[model samples]
Target: MRIRKKIWNNDAEPIIAIMVVLMVLGTINVFSSSFVLGTTDYENPYHFLRRHVLVMLAGLVLFFAFRKINYRRWRPLQGPLMLAVIGATFLSLVGVLVIGTEVNGAKRWLFGAQPAELAKLVSLMLAASTLSARIKRGKANSLFNVCNMKYGLIVVMAVLIELEPDMGTAAIVLGVPVIMAVVAGMSFKYVLGLGGFLALLILILVNVQPYRMARLKVWFDPWADAQGMGYQTVQSLSTIGSGGFWGMGLGEGVSKYEYLPEAHTDFAFAIFSQEHGYMGAFLVFLLLALLVLFCVRIANRAPDEFGQMLATGIMVLIAGQAIANIMMVGGLLPVVGVPLPFISYGGSSLMVSMVAMGMLLNICDHGRNAGGEFPKGEAKVTKSKDNKVHLKLVK
Candidate 1:
């Protein structure tokens, strides 16, 4: 078995195909979803369509860049990750307070030196990389050890994200790494036990906040608060149901004509369904499903644990967020302001999604180029100082 020295190793077909389809669908959906608002708010009709094109182009470049990079050297990145995640997330939160731009009562940046949207991918990478190294270092007591430095950093990232009060992104930032943890040799018992505790904390967090609690209530019966908290849900469901099977046709939907707020952002899925109908919605689901399947295949083919875990983390981020957004529109869950993955009209979110995909492509390449199983000594299991089983990092 030969270990290759260069990158660009994986077949780029899966990553490329998934991204191309997403960009096409997202472009179509964004134009249709944003039309009414864009025209009424701006003089030119193609305002958002043009912007989406630019963002997509930039994201494509970044994705291809990730495809070319190596995934194995992240081990030395351990110490700097904490500082990086903290500095970046805080700067975004603070920028929204200081010189940062505000969009909808919440502080997030659009055009600036720092992009908060990028934090999703950045924080996940930092979290994933940190744990992969430690697990390799023989920390697999895997239970109590989960509470130490590995999870500690993740908790800090979650805290900062919660402070941003952007619960949607915070959920994802935490959730993706948790998936990676499970893949990186976490115990089923502890994972399930911790999952239960986290769910309880989420319930308490949602109820403790008056708005979150209100949203939950409205989710159950939006008609009850149609004039207040339930207004969005009521309108969303109406739009969704109004579409029925075949939809009203592109740019012909009544809801986007000022009936539904946020027709392009949080509620974009509703608009997409209203225009494309159940068929369109199903196609969206199919596209997303294919994306995940190929990504999983890539993960399975990964050359190393770092590559596999990183790919898994990206898949979870995209698929999880997409489901959250779509379910919110379906009235199956409370509205959480999560953007539909590739289809949302925001640059930061779209660009970051592609970048994460790019990282996965890199991992795939590493896997393909990697060529063989563990070198003789590499597979030997070792016990840590505390008698926990752990694997050694590939040199």
Candidate 2:
């Protein structure tokens, strides 16, 4: 007990506390929302709950493993790490097309792994590593080249995910890197070109699929086709609306019983809003806000450009997914089927999210010792007498 207390006191308290709270609440809500589905499909009311608990246990192991590692150690091997992530993700994405399990008409999972979920984090890492390396080398002229190369891979990953029909994860995998590049001081002209290109791609993508077009139509007016493409959104909104202020009380929501699709996965927020009510929803948002704040605080205190970029990327990924989930459930945006981070009942997403959180905590710990003053002048890397590149952060 003393040892555990010491560990907690020595780490980032707010992040730890908030993560625990979210996990506990999420576990409870998963049981509440998924019991019916679990029973009907698997003949066990506790199937999802049991699976979620096991997944959460594995996630906890990953969390602690990442927390114990020094964040800077990754800097030395960023290139190889980036390549490995890209290669692994690409294979998984390709493999899914060949032999993957198709869930709800989307081939997204392979051998119990969701590569799209992994893409979000790995792409973020590659973005940070690439941008930071270029910046440290002071390759201002080659900024566009780096952007093209790194973002080109990101685009490929996004395309693969989109082919899986999982546009929500694709958007996040693509969006976070663009945000990081802009913040990393990429050329304005290049950024503009990138933005225009992305807009064109989105336009083309929306038109390529009939269902996507239908989604857009529903986004514009769900009431027009309340029983077709808009069914899920309308159902989700009705669930939230029925919750009132304090909710119908925990374990008492009526929407989860074959009324709302994806009550424990993509639309978990709807179930949460229904059971917890407006106040409960607000508390969930509060927790997410605190999580984002803690990440920003860690980024601000990061020791170098890489740490800052990595931390910021993780922050965007988590907060973006959460916001997208909330908006989709609240009828403020088209249903993109993004899950609420740490709250949704999925092994792959939960594991990936916990890993990101662990990385954030690691950054927080290292940032505490990082000096307050920002490094002035560009960092330079030079080959020493031993032919090894030595990095020097100039003040």
Which candidate wins on TM-score? 2
Stretches of model 2 off by over 4 angstroms after superposition: 1-11, 75-83, 137-146, 187-190, 369-395
Candidate 1 regions with alpha-carbon error over 4 angstroms:
1-11, 73-90, 110-115, 134-141, 369-395
Candidate 2 pairs with clashing backbones: none
lDDT of 1 by residue, 59-117 (tens): 88887876676655443244564456556665665555566666666555635422556
Tens digit per residue, CA lDDT, model 2, 311-393: 98999999999998898888888888688998999999999999998988887776543334333643334457854445566
Q: Which ten residues in a row have the lowest lDDT in candidate 1?
A: 372-381
Residue 6 in model 2: lDDT:
39
Give the clash total for candidate 1.
Answer: 3
True lDDT of residue 22, candidate 1: 75
Backbone clash pairs in model 2 (N, Cα, C under 3 Å; residues 3+ apart or in different chains), count: 0
